[model samples]
Target chain A: MSEHGERSAPGKGLVNGLAVTLKTMTRRSTTQQYPDVQPELPPRSRGVIALLEENCTVCMLCARECPDWCIYIDSHKEEVVVPGAARARQRNVLDRFDIDFSLCMYCGICIEVCPFDALHWSPEFEYSELDVLDLLHDKDRLGAWMPTVPPPPAHDVLGEPSKEEATAARKAAGPGAPTAARTARARPETPEPGK
Target chain B: MPLWLDLLVRVVAVVAAFLVLPLLVGQAEHKVMAHMQGRLGPMYAGAFHGWAQLVADGVKFVQKEDITPRDADRRVFQLAPVVALFPYLIVLLAIPLGPGGLVAQPLDVGLFFVLAVLGIGVVAVLMSAWASANKYSLLGGLRGAAQLLGYELPLVLAAASVAMAAGTLSLPGIVEAWSPWWLLWQAPAALVFFVSGLAEIRRPPFDMPIADSELVFGYMTEYTGLRFAFFLLAEYVGIIVIAALTTVLFLGGWHGPAAEHLGWLWTLLKVFAVSFVIIWLRVSYPRLREDQLQRLCWLVLVPVALAQLVLTAAVKVAL
Candidate 1:
């Protein structure tokens, strides 16, 4: 058996050597021309932070959850009417929200723990700046949408049928029925005491 | 111009050829090897598949830092690259590139002159090793000396066969006598010459002295930046010299169709072809064991070379 192993050694070695050479020849090169071709980062790629301003409820959850304390939020009380109520209710209005991305580790825990879906990961990685303070993204900078987002995966599109139906219904209804779907989707069984 | 002035012009022409042409040949070798292995090489460096890569590399190397080890023998460390580099340049003075392409007075003792000049490169390796004061460097230097000594005998014997057959040591004289190319006629001697040449240059399957993995870059472990680049340049230059010598002695030194008008072109093509094979062998084969390398030189190559030399002499006397 040992003699057989010795006899086959040279043959195996030749094959192994050729395999390595061929693999190196065919492998995709790791080098990238950074200034020329921008890399296509994935959907969840942690590059920078963006916010959905309309959906934010001023809960300050993102700021509270942030490990680095990079997120800063200030809010004030605002009147919001309860559904079918005569009197208005007081709630907190978000006055400021800022994220200093220079100090941010991009752990995505803030995004994950955000109840209002206000905080999101954006794929714009190129953010070089001369001033160290310029990298500190304030409320205005973080509020706008990123230019491009990787298209949602196929399974996500398939899973959200109501959203697709609502989009189709909106297209059919023309511009007149802006809030028709939301009104129709609201439950009527629960009654209000005063109206 | 006086005779001395004429000689100086010839020396300049030879130096230019040695310095410039080998770089072009090395570039061609890279492209050919890339094609054979199924890829495009250096397609963007210049207009045509990085033809100017060597030029770019040369500029970069010169602009790089010239570093020396703090503990090194500074004078010898600085001198090593110059010593390594100049011998290959001198060897090119003796090589006959083609008809009317003889650079200097073609000596009757051209073969011996080529060997003696090329042998000086080993001294550079030794100097680098000892001057660095590193154990691995010393081992590499010792290995280089032993390897060169072992291989040089077979290489000389192989060349002696061609000299004996042609009844001359002058390179142009040897080429002038070959009605058919000498390589085909003296097949055994050509084989011995090529194998020994590979060993002499320490190219792979015989690159024991500078085995990068085992010895951490061998004798050149301490050399960095421009000094290392010089050693690299000398290696490729040495490859070109060996290929040129092989062409002159065995492959009929530029004798081909259109013998006058296109002789230099044919000579360059042949030399480039041989150099490609050497580079291909480097990429294809793994390095041999040090003991195996020594054994192969002494046991196999020297005996084959000796036999060919004896056979060539006997045939010459009979003819």
Candidate 2:
């Protein structure tokens, strides 16, 4: 009993506690009954790391920034044939990208440091594995989580439009508007030949 | 019936009760405690409110590795669980569930026998404590012994007051002598006996010996597997024994409406109701500290028990 508990008439607190528990016993339990009923997680809830493979430039920024060194990346430089260029330009082609989820602290550093906007947070968390080694999610497996990734929540303060959105807005304004590329920073070129 | 056959039947009945009632109380505790805390306790095991949860626990306990400490007195350490478990089995025999020779073994001095046998639990605590060669175990054992010693006086005194009111020590005889007015007359002694009985069984508020926070399960720290399971079974059996005894002694055992035909039912209902109260008390009160435990036993319970004794004596003489 605390000092306050002592000041109440002796045994009154004991009776009151018993009454509280008895009353609680009659009320509906607050249990969520997980597995039977899915939880109502917020839209941007960080359940797992998802990958947008098409957006990855094989920059290795995410791998370098990962504190746990759980991320693995492998890429080889390939010559790209431009439609009308004198010299062929070289670009990094992604071969392998895997995240060892067993070692991941889920610090979001990998997602934050990715300049290509490849990594995203997905709310589909129920991917438990029987073996620890199986937790290492390859790029294909990570990409599978992309469909479950919810769109980013609307900003609390709608301050600055993203370059893509701003470019779209300019294009909509007039036919003689400045080209979208000049209006915004230069767009990163896609390495793949087919659209 | 042949005497041997009769004895065998009674023994079997007692043994079956000894095995079953404790499990029921344990399951009740699991559900009751959960609901009281606003949680759906166990939902998965039996597919129906976790009815087989304790059954699964029993299987798990059996599958666990029985570890014996290398430095421990292996013989005494192993024997402790048996000692802890068997006294309640013996005490259960004399508890009359209803009228007309309904008891398993109707002893003339059933109250004395029950009280004396229940005292052996402290020996079990001491055995496990000293045998484990752990300092915490020893401290818990010492605390258990001290608590039991302090509270035993009131427990016995309260029972004795009831014995005086009935003018007999036979449980069924006491029940036969009981009247509804005894509810008001013996209320104080009933309160003392029930509380002291809680202390005897080391139930919470009175559970200083096994203070998990301070003592790491006290005398049971080194126990594992089936040996540990035995100790848990012993605790549930202790609850049943206490509830049954409180029912038999104070609540007029099987004396209720339609008790002639449903005497045993009345006894069982009373026992389960008392057992629920025991669980409620555990849920309600934080454990009393050691000094508070002693003070409650000596200053409060003992005096109340003594006063009930005097009142019973005076009423008996005047009537």
Candidate 3:
């Protein structure tokens, strides 16, 4: 009954409303000045595709797997004498790597399928062109976005290093080096199959 | 003063009112309302605080395509904005800027003329809506008619109560009748006038006719280019006139210490002050439901206005 009576107080609601608006009117405004001030994007946000040329072995996996058939790759075999062996060897040297952005749907299948870790998602998505054909970015342009692809998020201090990093580190350290610390830290937390 | 000169002055005043006041009022509304809602409003287009935004907007409106729907009544659709805007511009002729014959004409029946001309805009709204042949526009037209029916009585009654107290139909006469405490004397009528006038102009809280969420720009939906600009201009003009009328009746026209010297300035200040409050009210209140709005006008405003009218007449006669 008291609550109902409060709601019925004639013009009280309107007065209260005016008071609220008046209070807000005096407070500092919260308008963002866009364009003039570029927004701070997250480091991990997927923006554009970047290519690491060194890691690419012309495996044709990204091109073969692309749903859009947008990734066009060309390569030629090069023969070279082995440094220690008595025989000559042939290797696929990359000739051309072009991603037709007009057709490349940015589905990230190319990035996911690169077995040699040859592709990355770069946070540099501001390449617009007047002509559609101009969007067919070649290897050099794709590689230009590589420097902007932020280094992978820092490894947590107390956590075990990733398998790739650990294996690479072990290889660099030598074959017989004991990976005892990593095993000790990880094995206890590993859940058994039934449990 | 020569007759031609007087005519020129009046024309200039009316024209200036149309051109200048709209821009000033538009800017003030945008800036003030933005502050009220915790926004920086317009920050570009004028070197500082978007002062030239209205000019840019005018240019944009002019350049836009004048689209006429294939099914629309071409003549009425074309004529609606001209009809809506000109009468309100003429209505300003009666409103006094300063004491001692500073108004455009200041007719003996000025209030009567103002009220009659005020109804023309609503007619234009309905005409444009009906002419559009759109279902939503038809609903908007119906809503406008319903609002006119619900609120017109209180609007007339509120103004009439003031006329009764003043013993004249002229706005300048009402100003003369006031004893500087006109607000206290005619407080109830003023309240009715403000609320009913909001309904009359189809402003927020009473803007069911232009309910954007449901009706998609309402009666002016199909209008484009300059025609749309005209409707927008008419709304701002409507707000100015209502504020000026309220000033004359309740706030005592140009009744301040410097009125003789700076009377027109005081009038401008008071008019904008009233407009500021209206904009504030717009931001503060949510749109009233159709049923709720009708109930307010009929159940509350009409009864109060009626009582105030009777009370004012009796007091006038007794005194």
**Which numbered prediction scores highest in TM-score against the true structure?**
2
TM-score of chain A of 2: 0.75
Model 3 interface root-mean-square deviation: 0.7
Tens-digit per-residue lDDT, B123-198, candidate 3: 8988998999998898988998899777889999999999988989988888988876667769999999998998
User: Model 3 scores what on Cα lDDT?
Assistant: 0.87
Compute the interface RMSD for each candidate structure. 5.0, 0.5, 0.7
Q: Is candidate 1 or candidate 2 better by lDDT?
A: 2
The order by descending TM-score is 2, 3, 1
If both were scored by TM-score, which would come out higher, candidate 1 or candidate 2?
2
Off by over 4 Å in 1: A1-31, A41-46, A60-70, A80-85, A100-117, A129-135, A150-195, B25-78, B100-103, B179-188, B214-216, B222-229, B307-319
Q: What digit string (tens of lDDT, one per residue) describes model 1 on residues A1-195?
A: 145655655457656665565455566545454666788676688788888777788887788888999988888998987999989999877788888878899899888898777777888888879998998877778876444445445555323245456566666777755443454457433221111
DockQ for every prediction shown: 0.08, 0.67, 0.64
Q: How accurate is candidate 2 locally (lDDT)?
A: 0.91
Evaluated on CA atoms against the true complex, candidate 2 attains a DockQ of 0.67
What clash pairs does model 3 have? Answer: none
Q: Which predicted model would earn the best lDDT?
A: 2
For residues B143-203, what per-residue lDDT tens digits would candidate 2 score against the true structure?
Answer: 9999988889999999999999999999899999999999999999999999999999999
